[model samples]
Target chain A: MNLPDRHISLAHGNGGRLMRELIELLFAKHLKNPTLDVQADAVTLPLERHGELLFTTDGFTVQPLEFPGGNIGSLSVHGTTNDLAVSGAIPKYLSLNAFIEEGFEVAALERIIISIAQAAKAIDVAVVAGDTKVVRRGEGGGVYLATTGIGIKTTEINLSMSQIQPGDRLLVSGPVGDHGIAVMLAREQFGLRGDLMSDAASVLPFTQALLDLPGLRFMRDPTRGGLATVAHELCRGTGLRVNLDQSAIPLRDPVVSVCDMLGYDPLYLACEGRVVAVIAADQADQALQRWQALPGGELARIIGETESNDPFVVLHTELGGSRILDELEDDPLPRIC
Target chain B: MNLPDRHISLAHGNGGRLMRELIELLFAKHLKNPTLDVQADAVTLPLERHGELLFTTDGFTVQPLEFPGGNIGSLSVHGTTNDLAVSGAIPKYLSLNAFIEEGFEVAALERIIISIAQAAKAIDVAVVAGDTKVVRRGEGGGVYLATTGIGIKTTEINLSMSQIQPGDRLLVSGPVGDHGIAVMLAREQFGLRGDLMSDAASVLPFTQALLDLPGLRFMRDPTRGGLATVAHELCRGTGLRVNLDQSAIPLRDPVVSVCDMLGYDPLYLACEGRVVAVIAADQADQALQRWQALPGGELARIIGETESNDPFVVLHTELGGSRILDELEDDPLPRIC
Candidate 1:
């Protein structure tokens, strides 16, 4: 912890004394575990012989490194792990890559690293390996994190878009657009401010609770393109029409108000900690009940269903009409994740 | 292949139609393999149950993205895989993360992706998972890459600094400082030019060749901080004095000239493709012969040896005088790897 500089410099990434000190004092100190060896080129992982291995990766470049409920550090961990979670796996190990800009505050870096450690510890996942690189000033965002997660799939059920049928129902674990709006408001670009926190927590519990159900077809965390994008994916993958009821979907008051004020579609906004699951029509109610029993799934609802052979995402209106939800083109928010 | 824009935009990382097209046409097309599933949130990997699993990660931020012998794309693959290689493991899978700046050339991106594919294919490794993010122009280097490699340790031999003893001999696979000087000259900051290509390549062949040698105590690729820094690491780790013979160390003419002109120490320069190994004195000549028989190991030499209990890296000058080689402080070359 004998860091001599308050701000990072190019030497910190030079693989020299400074780089070693930064990694040892900051990164390794925060993410210390039995599996992590700063001196070794690689660490060995212990795995069971029977289960299928799962691998997933994600990159986080959210603006305003610190957001309402989570920062890029915590979000990076949740994001990659959730990918494995929705795929019916238990995340066990993560490898982190940090791209830090020269001149960034060392204290801020420590805070983010601490956040990453806390989030990873919460889920019992260890950051077994990591690398740090420093980009020259103006050549990087304050910090960008990329995490690759390794997991083990113990479930007998195979969940995939190919498993979806025409009559399969769609259920959401919670409200959508909370993460997107929370980040936007944090930016204060439109002079908007709110106490809304991002719902950027792990979706492991929600995905695990329904794994025992034979009716579960597929599950995906609605991330960058949100609920409607997941709907579009289902349509494209299954070659079916997606019918979403606007009145049935759950939306928070603040998220709805912000979307209304900014002329953005809540359905297409990103949600970090939500799950849109495809379930057999007969078991949709049971899935909803199970999700609702979870802490973050109070607003769990059956919002949509797949039908017909056409590949279109249709949102049913309250006025007894429906409109097509086009695929995302222009980015409404850049670096949202 | 039907990309409309000549340059990348923010939408390409927004997890939308554009992102899908870019991934499908560029990344997924080139990196296609049986284990890679672009549509799946997480891909399943087939791993043997008996072998120890090795995990390693590295981040690449080399400026002028492309150099004489390689680009950041190829370097990223080699860098991460090399870590596993020196750890006495056979690299199997890799997960790539790219942080690209908006307004970058699409064609250049394609070339880099192709290089990545080619390099991975050369080593018979697969890029099973990946993620991409776009930073606003001026907020990032052209592109930064992070790769996490997963390999299985089939060899029962354990290589570590803890296994080192007095009288251990040191051998380098090839000439040093080529990669550092090559990248530096590529920048044209020193107004120097050369036909020297980077030594950036996988050290799998070198390390694999010596894994069967029971006399081999430890091996490391002389990367960012080069051979001298590695020697310092040996001294610090084992509390042993390292005696390096300057004349015996291999150094290419162009690298030596560049270092003399730039007033930089060749010992501290990076070598992306070289290996500095510690072997028992009784078997040092055997290890050297094995390395010299390889394609890029013509200059392989026994450069140094460990002796006594004092923790100092001493350079034995050709004049019979010795000087202590200090641990690297200032970074002469940043992002050489």
Candidate 2:
């Protein structure tokens, strides 16, 4: 029997002939890999010796589904990959689950699947397993993608908040808030229009550059809550104070202008492809230089320093005044990924 | 700051202070384990020596969110766990990603989370990492769960269709169509109301019982599209034919009644806690006896045998006549999980 032509139907998820056709024609056709077996309910892999395993999961509910620099498909891969990369792991395999609405167009689903395939290929990660489910039209969003990533930690590098010292230096990789602004522009909200693109690329290379740094204490990808929220989390239960030099931080002109027009602070806006690293103060300059030489880290800068006294994040404004950058209380925008 | 008392909002997924509070109060409070660290983006685990790693993913979109015997939370855990169990692995860790609607009630979320914790605890599996995303009210079903399970294949027991041969016996753990019937009854779509409950539970014990059996060739948890679909898959490309005895397959009275009333085939409906196993014909009785002694395997029986002549599933009716059990063409029910 021929599969449905235009829109996805419940039969595609029924685990029968049509579902088998969908998997073969759409998923396997694009995301083919040696480890992916449609007949097997689970994929088996040989464990890498002398390596610790890292596991991470994320859900992509970004509005518009497709955005300026990337779509939800690529974001799903990058989100999980970045999580493992920041934790000092080499991403290897991924499991994807797509919850598609009944009325969603099959062509769009194919495009997203292709993007997912391309993103995984670029990072040398395999889409080893996947599941699909269809909800009634109004009951589901366009498509919510959830990805689980498994990586192997090959290095002895340990990055955690517990190892952070008072003299640690906080560095920001490239500009902030590009992804949030890009999503907002894609929604056409606030009558906003620009050529701005999201910084939604993978941070694997950026993270790798600092992986060997002896003084690296902790690293994180500032995705949903941006750089400031990451800072707040780093010092929340600890007696560490993060003092940020706002003027030294890098920001794209369009992102800065967008933040100015709206009441949103770029520091708190999302960045799908940026990393916040805490390194020793003595090695901060060398780390910044190494990052600047990389492709996505030309604008890397040491923007803050940790103190032993207060437990709050203090931002020194361009006007020489200081204020506490408290944790975000409300949702500035939703589905920004 | 206090978390919202009533319903979930976009703020709860913003990765800000509210999201943190939600995680700490609801998810962390219930699903907390040594591997579930709030501060880490990914969890690190030590690898099991001499064991192959198994990975599986599944999305649960069960309607009504809560059903007679299990809710989506428990279903999510059972679905992924069963997939691994049937693959000859012991489930170790799970990564959960929740896509919640804006107006979903907090009380319901808490209940579901508690159920997830309970289900994981029953099997000694850990929810090592998780993610939460909230979509707008209309864009999301109340809550959709996606889970990825990691398991360790400790033994050399390989179970796959490639190992199946002619004259192999097919055995089922228990009654069929209970999950589908239970969900359909919960929907009240057909004015159906009874004490029918979903057979949604962990199949680890059942799968474990037969792990060391030398006659076991393959095992599968008949889920969506059920026994018929699994039979179709087992013989599709193998030039093998499956012959099933309709009278011998165990069926709950209510499930049989519902299928008869609705003109639905019980073999085509879903089953959550059932396993279809292929064992050597000579050892079929031994496997059946072993399974029948288990708690959920009271009705275990050898209901079918595979042949090498044809590639279709031939069903012998109660009248002693045979017919083809074709693959499901359209969905009789959606979001049945």
Q: Which stretches of candidate 2 lie over 4 Å from their true place?
A: A1-5, B1-5
Interface CA root-mean-square deviation for model 2: 0.9
- Chain B TM-score for each model? 0.98, 0.98
On residues A89-185, what C-alpha lDDT tens digit does candidate 2 reach at each position? Answer: 9899999999999878888888889899999999999999999998888988778999999998875878889889998999988999999999999
lDDT of 2 by residue, B1-337 (tens): 2334678989999999878878889999999999898778889975566778899999999988999999999999999999999999999999999999998999999899999999999999999899999888898879999999999887588888989999999999999999999999999878989899999999999899998888899999999999998999888845799999999999999998988999999999999999999999998998899899998789988999999886999999999899999889989877899
Q: Is the docking of candidate 2 incorrect, acceptable, medium or high quality?
A: high
Best by lDDT: 1
Docking class of 1: high
Q: Which 10 consecutive residues of model 2 chain B have the lowest summed lDDT?
A: B1-10
Model 1, range A1-337, lDDT digits (tens) per residue?
A: 4443489999998887888999999999999999999888999987776678899999999998999899999999999999999999999999999999999999899989999999999999999899999989999889999999999987486999988988999999999999999999999888999999999999999999999999899999999988888998898898999999999999999999989988999888899999999999999999999899999889999998999857999999999999999999888877899
Q: Which RMSD does model 2 reach against the true structure?
A: 1.4
